[model samples]
Target: MPQPHGFRYEELADGAVVITHLERAAGTLRGPRAQQFLAEVVTGDPQLVMARWTGNYKRGNERTARNHPRNRH
Candidate 1:
């Protein structure tokens, strides 16, 4: 485990799923600081993550679903 961690020290576990996905890409990350920071955050929690998740964020189908007519079955 990393000593003196600071990522989620006081935050609620609301966005853990998002965080978990990012850690898997640390190796390809271009910045040393970012990679190191992510490592510190995910060290203790296997389920925790830090994903980039930007490829289709704006055009994803899930977002459109919410705004669609709810009456459709």
Candidate 2:
């Protein structure tokens, strides 16, 4: 069967079909840290993920501001 543009389909050994977005998949995480993060995402609630990311962004901005030399004046 022909796949649609930007999408690909694979049939697993167990006969399950997995359809993926080619563009999106290209940007996804790789390596052990990515695996650990994915495991958390798959097992935890979306709200927790949102909260964690929000806090991370907030702290990142704060760190940037703190390290800016102009802030000393």
Candidate 3:
């Protein structure tokens, strides 16, 4: 079936509907430098850090997200 613009929808036999949006293209970052930056931000408030990080991600600032140590692997 044709997928909806910008998203996908699925209906299960159990009468459940699931809709998912397409994820934006991810950006890549090199190693150690990214890890170091993540370490520096680790102590910040989780919610606030994530909000700012996501904004940067959406703006094509993959370098910031890519630098996240967890994302290295």
Scored by TM-score, the top model is 2
* C-alpha-based local distance difference test score of model 1: 0.36
The C-alpha TM-scores of every prediction are 0.23, 0.29, 0.27
* Lowest summed lDDT window (length 10), candidate 3: 1-10
The best-first sequence of candidates by TM-score reads 2, 3, 1
Question: lDDT tens string, model 2, 13-46?
Answer: 5543333454343222345544554566558653
- Weakest ten-residue segment in model 2 by summed lDDT: 50-59
Q: 4-72 in candidate 1: lDDT tens per residue?
A: 212222222442222222233222233454456456656744223332222322234655787789934
Candidate 3: list runs displaced more than 4 Å.
Answer: 1-7, 20-59
Error of 3 at 28 (Å): 29
Model 1 misplacement above 4 A: 1-28, 51-73
RMSD each, Å: 12.7, 13.4, 17.3
Pitting candidate 1 against candidate 2, the one with the higher TM-score is 2
For each candidate, the alpha-carbon lDDT, in order, equals 0.36, 0.43, 0.42
- For candidate 3, lDDT tens digit of each residue in 1-73? 2212343333445543333345542222235534433554468643333334333324455678799998897
Listed per model in order, the count of residue pairs whose N, CA or C atoms clash below 3 Å is 5, 0, 0
Q: Regarding lDDT, does 2 or 3 come out ahead?
A: 2
